[model samples]
Target: MLETPYVAVDVDVLDRNLAGMAAVARERGLGLRPHAKTHKCLEIARRQVEHGATGLTVATVSEAEVFAGGGFDDLFIAYPIWPSPGRAERLRALAGRVALRVGVDSAESAEALSAAVGPLDVLVEIDSGHHRSGVRPADAVRVAEAAERAGHRVRGIFTFPGHGYAPGQQHTAALDEAAALSAADLGDGVRSGGSTPTAPLAEGGALTEIRPGVYVFGDAQQVELGGCGWDDVALTVVATVVSRTGNRVIVDAGSKVLGADRLAWATGFGRLPEHPDARIVALSEHHATIEFPAEPPARGDVLRIAPNHVCATVNLADELVVVRGGAEADRWRVAARGANT
Candidate 1:
């Protein structure tokens, strides 16, 4: 078997994580709209739907289009997208094909979206604690009312508790989400909120849907932050050691493939599979300098690296080899890998 620089997916672990999340959503009576931005593979998306995901959540309209064309009938563009004239036509065309839901943060954008795609299902994004693109909890009603006035239907409220990614913040973030949604008066509608880090702590009360992406492929940051264990890591970059020194070994994969997602608390660029303690200290476009604690990699040895963030790492790959029990079983193409627009 040829092994050098390749993206590999551990099918067993990935299936387990998908099933676990689906079970969580079922138990809570909430919708599981797993973010497609994680893997972006049609095969993985099919598995998610098969495991009982209500629909797919995407970060961009391009991603939504890709999945919709690939036969995913239900999708939610979770970002507060300001659709231009052309993009608006695209959105309307997309809505005609699938059950497309979009996110809106302000009255102006809502009005614009309503004018473009009349009477569409929209979610008023509430800023729980992320301070990203969302209206305040107290302002959610105002935005929803505006969208309603523009002839759009307000489905419910949604938020991204991205602050929950940090340690000791998941509980607070979840509380914020509950309070925000409650205050927003999103009654009998879908109050959606949840990140990978906050998924376990997310209660079933107000949140009717959870959009967790990274849990499918546990990253180094997830492992370091205690969100997931090393065994839960389902994806890895298989790269061959090209250069070797006393303590530093350079690999053939770098930021282009592994991605540059070093959080403040992250120990290094990535984690080596054989020696989890080893740190990928430096990363260039095509080279990664790994500092080994012990058992330095040989010049021709292939090293599997767990990325700091799996979502970004996945966007870099064109395709992924689905491996089960140490053997490659299938290949999945990343249908929306570069669908950034």
Candidate 2:
């Protein structure tokens, strides 16, 4: 038996999620390159490859290095990276070791990246309604031309429909993504766009790939947004109730493990799959205040918490307790846990 306040992944649920995503990608004739920033585990990454993922998408150079070092050959650093000296050296080394691709949105970073990594494959990022790290769709060709002028091979354009996370926004965000990709005149190449919320609806004449990461481990946010059902949740934080008063039960899980990301639409800090009516009303460094529908459970009762965001939750974990038949089956290291650069 393992200790409380630990993260556990149901192998059966995970396999089903993997197979479902692979089937979706295959049916759409889109390349599945699930983002590794979700699980950040070599075991899960290997499973994604085995399940038909053409490659993996990472957020940072360190993350790319970790997975590439762990034997994943094709990696796409999806973020617009302005390389520091150390990051440049690492990117150069990674380029020599794997099929490395990076994103660029400006000429300055493109020129600097070329100087640092020496003619690497590049993708110009197009803004798909998230308005985060990408240029306007009309500016995609401009960025691609700049990267090409900097001696980098411009592969294609990509976007992230981050706005899809909200309720009733997925279909619109997907439409925006498709429109953006259609407007980004980058010739014929990989036009990638996707998020777990928008993946099912991601369709454009120009789309050739999708990079959704969170489908492997359903979370509270996904559940609330109707992206996945409670039974589809594969990962949960197993916490023990330490105190109970009236209708409130305080658990051992906190922001340190569950992450501090609460979307505006989220009902609470987290949720209890076992107690569907209970809500984690608040969280401190090491405690969660749950509001129960009725009389609270007695102290020492175990609760499985689905965090509002699984990516941040996985990043906080050191290992994922693989559960099978309601028992611990194995432990998988979060190999890329601290790979933030």
Candidate 3:
């Protein structure tokens, strides 16, 4: 057995998740360019490519570099990043190395990125519902036109159904995303939108592509939002119970290992799959306080914790311990971990 406080990926579950998403994309006639910001593992990315991903979507330039170094030829930086001088240099390098695409939510971002990385492909970001980034669907043409003026190739518009990660909101969020993209007249460009919760409903009419990241490792947020069941959770943190007091116990895995990204809808910081009623009440840098049922596991017992946010949790780990046949099978490095530019 590998040491506790380590991140583990159930190979069977991971493969099932990948196949499930790929099947949906194939059936919908939608392009599958899964976000690499979730697993950040070359092994997982390769598996996704084998399962029919057309390209990889990443959040940062460094992540693109890591995956590009791993031989992934096509990449999309799916964030409206304001390129600094250093980031501009890196983006220029990445542009030369791969089929690079990026998101542009404003004319300023479009112009800046175009000047930094000449002739790169740009996707106008439309604010479907999340109100995070992205221009309004009605204003997508302005951003696309600006990108064109900057001498960049406009690949069309995309939206993220970020609001879909809530109870009974996936369908509505997906519809909103579709409506936004339909309203944006991009003219034969790639209209993309989808989150893990809304991907199952993605269709061909409005979107030509779907870029979801957390499907490979369903998290507590996905579970509560009904995106996936506990059984679908592929990645978890393996922690050893160190101290116990009645129904509450301390585990070796904490915020540093499991990530501290509990959503408002989440019951706790994380979930204990074996003890469904248990809640991770608190987390220190290296310790997790879990409150379980009457019959709590004893000290020194190893437990698997499904985190609230799999993407952030994966970014915290250096490697993932692959589990097979209920045992550790291999160690896969999180090669893109800390690759935040």
Candidate 4:
């Protein structure tokens, strides 16, 4: 038997998720470059590629290096990376090894990227209501031109539309992303857009590629947003009930393993798929306090809890116990875990 407080991945559910997303991308005629930061597992990444992923999107250079070293050469670091001397050297080497692209949002960053490593493929980041690290649509051209001046080729523009994460905002955020990309004049570069919530509605709206990270393993936030059903959750933290009260059951798995990323709109710290009404009310380092709606689980009863954020939860784990046909089939290393740089 596998140990408790470990991350369990249902391979059947994972394959379904991958195939579903691939079918959608094929139907939409959009390039599917899923964000790899969500799983951070080489096994999962290979499966994604096998499922017709055109390439993989990543959040950091370190993640890019890991994947590239693993022979997944087509990588796009979607974050607006500031090129320090060390990072620039790394980027330069990665470019030499693989087809590398990086995001840039400002002339200053463009210069830094170029000075550190010249003649790189750069995508200008446009702020489509996220108000994050991206330039506005109107300023996209300016940044693109600045990138050209800094010796980088402007390949396209991209946006996050992160506002879609909230309730009742997916369609609106998608519209905003389309509108922003439509308004931006970045020559004939590819227009990339998406967040997992906005990806479905992103078709035919100035997007050639979509980078969604969360669909691989539906999380509590995605469930609350109506993005996935309870059965769609592929990753969960396996824990054993250690204590019980009236309606409270304590599990050995907590934030240390499951992560603590409760969104403002989230119902609780995490969720119990086996008992949908159960709420992870409190989470300590190695304990999860769950409030069950019905009879509490007796001590020693094992359960699985879906994390609030699948990405954070995956980052916390060293490996994923991949279950196929209801058996422990394999253990996939979280190869890119803690690659936050």
Candidate 3 Cα deviation (angstroms), residue 83: 2.4
The regions of model 4 sitting more than 4 angstroms off are: none
Q: Write the per-residue lDDT of candidate 4 for residues 1-341, one digit (tens) a residue.
A: 67899999999999999998888888888899999999998888999999899889999999999999888989999999988888888999999999999999999999988887888998999999989889989998888888998899889999999999999999999999999999995767789988888888886648888999989999889999999998999999999999998999999998899898988989999998989999898999999999988889899999989999999999999999998877899999999999988
Alpha-carbon RMSD, candidate 1 = 1.2
Query: So what's the TM-score on candidate 3?
Result: 0.98
Sort by TM-score, top down from the best: 2, 4, 3, 1
Each prediction's RMSD to truth: 1.2, 0.8, 1.1, 0.9
Model 2 residue 30 CA deviation in Å: 0.3
After TM-score superposition, the amount by which residue 293's alpha carbon in candidate 3 deviates from its true location, in angstroms, is 2.4
Predicted candidate 1 versus true structure: per-residue lDDT over 35-107, tens digit per residue: 9999999999999999999999999999999999899999999989897988898899999999989999999
Alpha-carbon deviation at 181 in model 1, angstroms: 1.7
Which pairs of residues clash in candidate 3, taking residues 3 or more apart in a chain or in different chains? none
lDDT of 1: 0.89
What TM-score do all the candidates reach, one by one?
A: 0.97, 0.99, 0.98, 0.98
Query: Candidate 1: which stretches are off by over 4 Å?
Result: 1-3
lDDT comparison, 1 vs 3, better candidate? 3
lDDT of 3: 0.91
lDDT (10s digit) by residue, model 2, range 1-341: 68888999999999999999999999998999999999999999999999999999999999998998899999999999998899989999999999999999898899999887789999999998998999998888878888999999999989999999999999999999999999995888999989999988978466899999999999999999999999999999999999988999899889999999999999999888888899889899899999998989899998899999999999999999999989889999999998899
Local lDDT at 307 for model 2: 95
Q: Give the TM-score of candidate 4.
A: 0.98
